[model samples]
Target: MPDTSFPGAWSVDAEGSAPPFEQLRARVLDLVTSGDLPAGFRLPPVRTLAEQLGLAANTVARAYKELEADGIVETHGRGGTLVSAQGDAARRAAQQAAAEYAAKTRSLGITEADALELARTALSLR
Candidate 1:
C-alpha cells in the first residue's frame, strides 16, 4: 500500500521559466502519473500549499483547477481533493512504462529536452 500522505515537498521554482501555476500543475501530474502518489492521495489545501511554496492561494487554486480539468484529481467541497481512480489500470501501466524509460534515460544522463526530442522522434516513427 502506498503512503497516500499529503505530498508536501512538491515545490515551485520562482525563477524558472514556467509560470508558478503551470509548474505546480505539472508537479501534481508527475506525482500522480509516476505512482509516487498513488490513487486516493489527498492533496494539501490550496492555502496551505500556497504558504508552503510562497505562492498566492489563487495560484495554487489555479493549478488545482487545471488538475481537475485534466481528470487527474477530483475535489469535493469540504472533503478536500483526491487523486482520481478513474483510469487506474491504464494509468498504472503507463506510469510503470514511464518509470522504466526515465530510469534508462537518467542512466544515460539525458536532459529533459533530449528526452522530449527522443519521444518526439519516436512518435514520428510511429
Candidate 2:
C-alpha cells in the first residue's frame, strides 16, 4: 500500500554503505518487492519526481533509466510509465535475501550496537 498520491520521500540511511543512487534504487525495488506498487502501476514522471525531490531531473532520470534497462519498468508513450510484471517477484526475492543476510549476521550474536558500528565503518569507507 505505497501512497501513490504523491512523490514519496525516503530518508537516507547514513549508516548504509551503498551510494545514494543505489539506496534510491533499493527503495524503489523494495516498493515493488513489498507489493506496495504492483505490476502495471505507473510511476510518477521523471520531471515530477525530480521536482518533488529537489534533485536535478537528470538524476532522477538516470535512476529511472537504470530501472528501465533492468526490466523493472516500461514506457507507455503518453500513457506514462508502468512497472514490469516480473519485477515485483524479482525485487521481493532480492529484498528477502537482503533481510536474510541481516538475520544471519544478527543470529551470530551480532547486536544492534555492533550492526550500527559496522554500518558506520562502512559509511566512512564509502
Q: After superposition, how far is residue 105 of candidate 2 from its true place, in Å?
A: 16
Tens digits of per-residue lDDT, candidate 1, 1-126, equal 334344555567888878999988878877787777777788888898888789999999999998887678889987888888862544666688889988899899999789989978975651
On TM-score, the candidate that comes out on top is 1
Quote each prediction's TM-score.
0.65, 0.59
- Score each candidate by Cα lDDT: 0.79, 0.71
lDDT of 1: 0.79
- Which residue pairs in model 2 clash with each other? none
List, in order, the clash count of every candidate structure.
0, 0
Error of 1 at 113 (Å): 16
In model 2, where do residues sit more than 4 Å from their true spots?
1-3, 6-19, 89-126
> Model 2 residue 88 lDDT?
60
